[model samples]
Target: MADIIESAGVVLAYGVAGFAVMALGYLALDLVTPRRLSSLIWTERNVGAAIVMSGQMIGVGLVVAAAINASEFQRGLGVGLVSTLIYGLAGVIVMTLVFALVGILTPGRMGATVLEDRDGRPHPAAWVQGAMYIATAVMLTAALS
Candidate 1:
């Protein structure tokens, strides 16, 4: 029980670290670009959204892989390699589903919003992302153990 608890904590910590790193990277890119992200994407909301979400997909996969590594010290390397690849593919599918759903729900908003929306709203895309996340987590857990 204690081992499981510790493992969970480690995984969560790794996810936080990954998220922080990814956010910082995005911020740096924004500073360097110095242009409206939408403009760069030809003002196509869907295209810009896809590009941003693609980064998010990679970031989420990295965090998931890191978390899996934290959970298994001995076999972390093997599991990390496998999970990273699986999560990368899963992220692409999940992000595509997310952007599509967002386009449906918000109509014109898609990638137009300048501010972030992190409210705990019941979104279909969130559920999809969560499902993919959990499934990948479980696969890594099983592979390690």
Candidate 2:
């Protein structure tokens, strides 16, 4: 039916928007760290890097989902897509800022610390930084709702 097709189109649009936001998140994370993120995870097999990236991706997803849900209810499809993109980018920015702030307050650089591994195991800082990303996303979700 025409309605079904239209619904599918909306879904596609939203999907693209979410993907764009996630891509930005990845790029933001890549910028903060010293080594190339892809190399760190894929080539080096860095557990710490993997954990940090996973946390960022998950956090971005949460914020994107919340933005989409809230925007869809309050506005139409177009506005929803735009808002989702905006909110998702905001989430990325906030997460990056938090990372930087923590880096400043902590004894060592947060990004470098999280990427460190010992005997193939991730550093404790990795877990803490990862949680920070998720926690920041949770706060953003609350703000969106």
Candidate 3:
């Protein structure tokens, strides 16, 4: 019973820590982006922002999941936490680089392309960028896990 309780506490602690780490990843992405993502999504109701932000958050989550799956948290949750941070940050950084690379290859400026609209619709370039972000996450998660 005592061991079970201790294990439960560890899980809870790590779960919270994992979420905080993910939030930090989001902040990092927000800093890189030109527009305030929250304002664009909530205030402007920008579908482009919604898709891109959603992809970014999911990408970070996949990295955390991979870290948790790969690390032996039962041995030492502290070590597990550190591994999670390391792997998660790597995943975020890789995702960011993929986004930039895609944007560069894309005809127009990626940031501006994300905000571009045509005929009252979100531009196709934004969708492509979001897809690239998600695909990169999936690939990294597979390698990490």
For candidate 1, what is the TM-score?
0.35
Which regions of candidate 2 deviate over 4 angstroms? 72-75
Which residue runs does candidate 3 get wrong by more than 4 Å? 1-4, 118-120
Better of 1 and 3 by TM-score: 3
lDDT of 1 by residue, 8-118 (tens): 875665566455544543443344333554454445433333345445545455545544454443665445544544543444344445544654676344333422223
* Candidate 3 residue pairs in clash (backbone atoms < 3 Å): none
- lDDT of each model, Cα atoms only? 0.46, 0.92, 0.79
Q: Which candidate is the best by lDDT?
A: 2
Best by TM-score: 2
TM-score of 3: 0.88
lDDT of 3: 0.79
Per-residue lDDT tens digits of candidate 2, residues 1-145?
9999988998899999999999999999999998999999999999999998999999999999998987753567878888889888999999999989989999888889999988999999899889999999999999998
RMSD of candidate 2 to true structure, Å: 1.3
Writing each residue's lDDT as its tens digit, candidate 3 over 21-140 gives: 678767776776788878888888888867787888887887788888887676788888888777887888888888788877878778777876566688777787778778888998
* Evaluation by TM-score, superior candidate among 1 and 2: 2
